[model samples]
Target: MFSPFERMVAGRYLRARKAEGFVSVIAGFSFAGIMLGVATLIIVMSVMNGFRQELVTRILGLNGHINVYSLSAPLEDYSIMKLQIGDVPGVTSVSGIIESQALMTINGYSTGVMVRGMTRDDLMKKPVLSDHFIEGEPADFVGYSAAIGRLMSEKLNLKIGSTFTLVSPKAKVTPFGGMPSSRTFTVAMIFDVGMYEYDSNFIFVPLDAAQAFYQMGKAVSSLEIVTKNPQHLNTVKRDISLITDGVAGVYDWRDNNSSFLNALQVERNVMFLILTMIILVAAFNVISSMIMLVKDKGRDIAIMRTMGATRRSMMKIFILTGASIGVVGTFVGTALGIAFALNIESIRQFLQGLTGTELFSEEIYFLSKLPAVIDWNEVIAVIAMAFTLSILATLYPAWRAARLDPVEALRYE
Candidate 1:
C-alpha cells in the first residue's frame, strides 16, 4: 500500500528537524504567537460577555423587562391596567411602581433620593431587590418603613431601625404665596443591589405610603411587566400597548439600555480583531520560515524532483508543516483560555490585591468584580480562523517550492 501524499509530507516535515534548526525556531515563534493571541482574545471576550450577562440579569431582575407609563399623567386604573397587561402573551408578571423625588435627612446629613414605591407582593417578584435585603425586610414598609440602597445608607450613616425624615416637595395653595410645599415620610430600611446607581439613588417604600405622601389617589406612575422570555420584550411591549389602546407608552429593556449594550458589543468585536492580528502576524512568520526552508533544501528538492517527486507533493509538505504549527498552538491556547475564563474572578482578586487598587470598583464600573463567560462558539471560531490563516500563509512559499526547476536548482547546488 502506498502512503497518502498528506501523510508522507506531514511525516517527512515532522522528522526533518536536524537540518531545519532555524525553521523550527520560526515555527515555535509562530505557535507561541497564535497561542498567546487566541488565549488573550478568548479571555477578554469572555470577560466582556460576562459583564454584559451580569448587567442584564441584575438590572432586569430589579427593573422589569418592560415598563408601561402614561403619556399624559399618572396611570388612571393601575389595577385594571395590571390585569389587562398581565393577560398579554409572554407577560409573566406585572407590578405597579411609583417613583418620586424626595430628600432624606438623618443627623443633619441630607441626600436627594428617588423613592420607588411598590406593594409587598409586588416587591417579592423583583428578584434583584428581593435577594439583596442585607438589612431589613420589604414587608416592614407598611408603617413608614423604607428600603434604601447600600451607598445611600453609607452616605447617610443609616442602619436598621434608624429614623430619617423624607421631605417630598408637594405643591399646595397658600394664602400669602403662590405655592407651598409639603414633606412626606420617614426612612426605615436599607437595601443593597451591588449596583452604584441603584444603591445610591433609589429607595423602596410601601405603595400606599407613597400614594398618601404624593396625594395620588390609588394611582401609580408606571406598571412594570416581567416577561417569560426577555428576547421577546418588544413583542410583549407591543401587546401591552395594543391592549391599552395606545394610551400608555410601553418601554422594553432594549430601549432603556441599548447604548450600553451596543458599546459592549463594539468593544468585544474590536478586541477580537486586534488580537486576531497577532495570530496573523505569527502566520506570516511561518511564511518566512517556509521560504527559508525552501532555500536551504534547494539541493534536496532538486534531487527529489530528478527522482520523480511531484511538485504537488513538495507543496503539501510545506503546507502540512505550517498547519501543524497552527494546530498545536490553537490546542494549547484553547485550553489556557477556558482555564482562565473559569477562574477569572480569583485572578481578578489576586491582581486587585497585588496592585493595591480595586480593578472593578462598583463606584467606577457599576460592578465590584470581573466576570468571564466562555462561549464554545467563540472558541470554535478562533480555532477555525487560526488554522485558516496558517494554511493560507503557506501558499506563496509552497508555490515557489513547487515551481523550482530541477536543472536550475541542481546547477546552483
Candidate 2:
C-alpha cells in the first residue's frame, strides 16, 4: 500500500512539467515500447496456437490418430486385426487402408499421385474423407470407380463419369519382358479436404479395385485407428502395440508429422524469446527515464528527507511511478492483441487486397487463412514479466534519490 505522500509525489514526478520535457519524452517512449511488445507477442503466440489446433482437427482427422503396420509385409487378415484393435479400451474406430504411389493420365495431362484404397464402410467411417463430396456418393463407388480430389480434378479437367488411366510400377512379367500394370477407372466423385496438399495429390479407389490393380491378394498396407480421445493417443498406441505382440509397427499421428509440427513448436519458442527482448528494451528505457527524474528532483528529495520522509518512502514512490506505466501498457496491449487475434483473418484479407498479394498462400502453408487463438496463460505471463521488469528498473534510481544528503543537495542550490 502506498501512503498519501508517496502517491502524490509519484503522480507529480510522472506528470513532469515543461521544464523536465526530456524525461517526459523518455517515459512516453518506454510506455509505447512495452505496449507494442506485449501486443505483438500475444498475437504471434495466438496464431501459432491456432495453427496447431487446426492441424489436429483437420489433418489428423483425415489421417488416423494411430497407424498399425506390419513389420515386413502387408496385413493379410486386416479384418480380424481391425476387430481386435477396435476392442481396445480407448479405440473408437478401425479401418483397413491401402496407400500407394502411382501416376494418372487424363486428357493428355499426367501427374503423380498417392492412391488410397478403402471399402465403402471404411470410407464412411472417416467424415473427413466422406463428408465433402462434390460429385457422386460414396455408396456409388462400387466397381472400377474412383474418387479424385477437387484440385486434382481441376488440374486434369476431370468430371464425374470421366475415365482416366492408372499406371502402377508393379510390372507383370511376360514372355518378352516386364510390362507396367495399367488400368482404366471411371471417376465417381470429387472431394475437397480444404488442405491443399491432400486436395492436389490424393485419390480414392475401391479396395477391390486397388487390390486387383496393385496385384495385392487379401492384404492391406495398414490399419488406421481413431480413439475416443486423441490426446490419449500415446497411451493407446503403446497399449495396442503391446497387445499386438510387437509384430506390427504402431505409430501415432504426431510421429508421422513430427518434422512439420516440430518446426512449428521451435518457431513458436524462438519467437517468444525474440519478442521478449522488446519488453526488456522497454524496461531499460524505464531505468533511463527514472534516473533522469531522480537527478532533476534532487532538491525535492533532499527537502523530503529533511522533513522526515524515510528512505523506504522514496523507493516506494519511484517504484509506483515506473510500475504504473507498465500496468497501463500491459492492459492496453492485451486488449489490442485480443481484438486483433479475434479478427486476424479479416485483417489479413484487407492487407492482402491493399497490397495485391496473398498473405497466407495455400501453396506454402497447410492453412489457407490466417488463424489465431488467444491463450490467457500466455497473456498473464507476459504481463507479469513486464510489471516485474518495470519495478526492477526503478531500484537503483530510487536508492540514489533516497541516499542524497540534504546538506550537500542544498549547498549546490
Candidate 3:
C-alpha cells in the first residue's frame, strides 16, 4: 500500500509541469502505445473468433457433422441405416445423400458443378440449406426439378421455373460409341448458404430424381448425419461404428474439411503471436518512460531521501506513477476494443457505404458480411498481459531511483 505522501508525489510526477514537458510527452506516448496495442489485439482476435464460428455453423450446417458410408458399395438400404444411426446415442438426424459431379448448361453457358440429392424432409432438417430459400419452396423440388445456389443462379442467369440440362458422366453405348447421359431439369428454388464455394458450385435435387437420373436405383452414395455435440465427434463416431457393425465407414466434419479448418486455426494462432508483439513494443515504451521519469526526478529523489524517506517508499512512488499509465491505458483500450467489436458489423456497413466499394465480398472471403465475436476469456487474458507488462516495466527504473544516494544525487544539483 502506498502512503499519502507517496501517492501525492506519484500523482504530481505523472502530471509533470512545463519544466518536465519532455518526460510528460514520453509518458503520453507510452499511454497511447499501450492503448492502441491492446485495442488492435482485441479487434483482431474477435474477428478471428467470429470467422471460425461462422465457418463451423454455416459450413457444417449444410454438410452435417459426420458422414457414414458403406465401405463395400453404395448404401442400398439407407432406410434401415438411417433408422439405426438415428437410434444411436448422441445421434440427432441421419439423411441419405447421393452426390455426383455433373455439368449444367443454361443459356449457352456450360459449367461443372457438384450435384447432391436429398429428400425434402432431409433438406428441411438442414436449416443452413432450408432456411435460406430465396426463390421457391422445397415442395417445388419434385421429380426432374432442382434447387440451385444463389451464385449459380446468377452466373447461369436462372430463375424459378427456368430449365437447365444436366449432363452425367454415365454413358449409353450406341452406334456413336458412347454418349454421356443427359437430362433436362426445371429450376425449382434458389438458396444462399453464404459460402461462395457452395453457392457457386452446388445443386440439389430430390433423392428419387437423382437416383433415377443416375441409374442408382434406391442406393445412396452416403449418409449425412448430425449429432448432439459436434465437438465430440470421435466419441460419437466410435458409437456409430458399434451400431453399424464396422461395415460402414464414418468421417466427421473435421475429417472432411481438415485442411481448411487446420489452416484457419494455424493462422489465428500466428496472428495472435504477431499482434502480441505490438503489446510488447508498448511495454517497452513503458520502460522507457519510467526510466526517463526516474532521471528527471533525481533531485526529488535526493530531497526525499534527505527528508528520511525510505528506499521502499521511493520505489513505490515511481512504480505507482509508471504503472498508473499502463493501468489506465489498458482499461481505456479494453473499453474501446469491446465497443468497436460489438459494432463492427455496423461500422463495416458504414465504411462500405462511404467508400461505395464492396467490403467482405462473398467472392473473396466467401462471407458477404464482416463478423465479430468477442471471447471474454481472451479479452481477460490480454488485459492481464498488458497489466503485468506495465508493472514489470517499472521495476528496474523504480529500483534505480530507490538506490540513488542522496549526497551524490544532490552534489550534481
Best by lDDT: 3
Error of model 2, residue 335, in angstroms: 1.1
**TM-score per model over all chains:** 0.91, 0.94, 0.96
Q: What is candidate 3's CA lDDT for residue 112?
A: 90
lDDT of 3 by residue, 150-222 (tens): 9888887889999999999888679989888889999999998888888999999999999987888999999
Clashing pairs in 2: none
lDDT of 2 by residue, 253-354 (tens): 888889988998999999999999999999999889988888888899889989999989988998898888888888898888889999999999899899
Please give the CA lDDT of all the candidate structures. Answer: 0.80, 0.87, 0.89
lDDT winner between 1 and 3, please give it: 3
Order of all candidates by TM-score, from best down to worst? Answer: 3, 2, 1
Candidate 1 shows a clash count of: 0
RMSD of 1: 2.6
What lDDT, from 0 to 1, does candidate 2 have? Answer: 0.87
Q: 1-413, model 1: which lDDT tens digit per residue? A: 22476567566765557768777787778788889888888898899888888888888888888888888999967787788887888888888889889877777777788888888888877768888788766557786677878887787777777777777677655787645343444555666777788889887888888887777888999888888999766667677878777578888888889898998889988988888888888888888878887887788778878988889887877777677878888889989988999999898889988999877778777876677888889889988998898889888988988899989988845
Q: State residue 7's C-alpha deviation in candidate 3, in Å.
A: 1.3
Root-mean-square deviation of candidate 3: 1.5
